[model samples]
Target: MSGAVQAKGGSRHGDPNRLGHGEVPASERGPASKRIVVSYGFWIFLLSDFVMFSGFFAAYAVLVGNTAGGPSGRELFDLPLVAAETAFLLLSSFSCGMAGIAAAARNAFWFQVAMAVTALLGAAFLALELYEFVHLIGEGAGPDRSAFLSAFFALVGCHGLHVVLGLLWLTTMMAQVWAKGFREDILRRITCSALFWHALDIIWVALFTIVYLLGSGAGA
Candidate 1:
């Protein structure tokens, strides 16, 4: 009887030192269980965000020719400036990638530096973009003056808003890293941020090509 009791106890508490025994596989865990809600949520947010851009593209398609005797893309768009903006955004994306690599390696200092660099680049892009908008508006080419300008402002401004939001997110994540160290949750958040930043870069490339290159051709 004593031996049977001991045997049962051993089976019931087998390997008390074992971690996550008889639990769900890591990959099979739900988003909540794995603390991946932010990762999954960010992707959904991106998709919904893209829908807004799609609407803007449709509007631009309809209003591309409505120059209203002010100025068209060929007259207003400085391709070199737009190209510089593209390069800044692209570099930011690259920095974000480096941040992810640092996060994965658990190097907190390098990760923060990379994130800071990305934020600076994003800020520079926003500055250039706002300057272009202000310059255009100053020259009697405000959005309200023409359907084409209105569509252009709406599309581009929305993208700029996203960049601003992304910068805020990056700032928050940096703080989180500083407070919590490079835990798995923080690393996942950083990874999601990287994905989001890169997505913006890709969207900007498309926007640059369609709004700048194609618009210039149409105006010419």
Candidate 2:
């Protein structure tokens, strides 16, 4: 009631700077545009994802040394394979960037090509990670073998699941682009997906360092 009265009184008083008096209309400075809203919302989603990963990382840190008379990371991990996975994911990030560039320039052929490259690289990374997991489980170092392995699988498997989702998103994006051309909403989605793909790269780098490099060092 008071807010409405204030607006009414302000209008009656001819206040030059008041909102209802309309030096500048409220509509002119109203809600953010769709692109701004979508981008902002997607970043909030990414931050929440990071927070979830942080919890996983902390749990892994606490349990990293709790191997129950089982093989440690150094004994179980294959660094060469992990290194290859890292290479593939990093290259996917680069290719994703190229796809974004092509999208911005509205180059259909290059965008499709770059997106395909990104998808292939991302799939290759996932393949290597899956093989590593299967090999470890075959070697009797499965998650149930020890607390350390449990934490490792939880953190790394969560990341792998996200990669799978990202690949599905990329496939949808390519389909959307092909069907719709460079529509504004589609471009916004492409930008958000690129950001997401790059974020996975960053997380993998940290995972590689903490779970592989430092974890192995601890075994020494």
Among the numbered candidates, top TM-score falls to 2
- TM-scores, all candidates, are 0.83, 0.88
Model 2 bad stretches (over 4 Å)? 1-28
Compared to the true structure, candidate 2 yields what TM-score? 0.88
Provide the RMSD of all predictions against the true structure, rounded to 1 decimal.
6.1, 6.0
How much RMSD separates candidate 2 from the native structure?
Answer: 6.0
lDDT of 1 by residue, 99-153 (tens): 9888888899999999999999999999999999999999999999899999999
- The residue pairs in collision within model 2 are none
Would you list the C-alpha lDDT of every candidate in the order shown? 0.88, 0.92
lDDT of 2: 0.92
Q: Per-residue lDDT of 1-220 in model 2, one digit per residue for the tens? A: 9999998786768766564635556677879899999989999999999999999999999999899988888887778889999999999999999999999999999999999999999999999999989999998899999999999999999999999999999989999999999999999999999999999999999999999998778747
Per-structure clash totals for the candidates: 0, 0
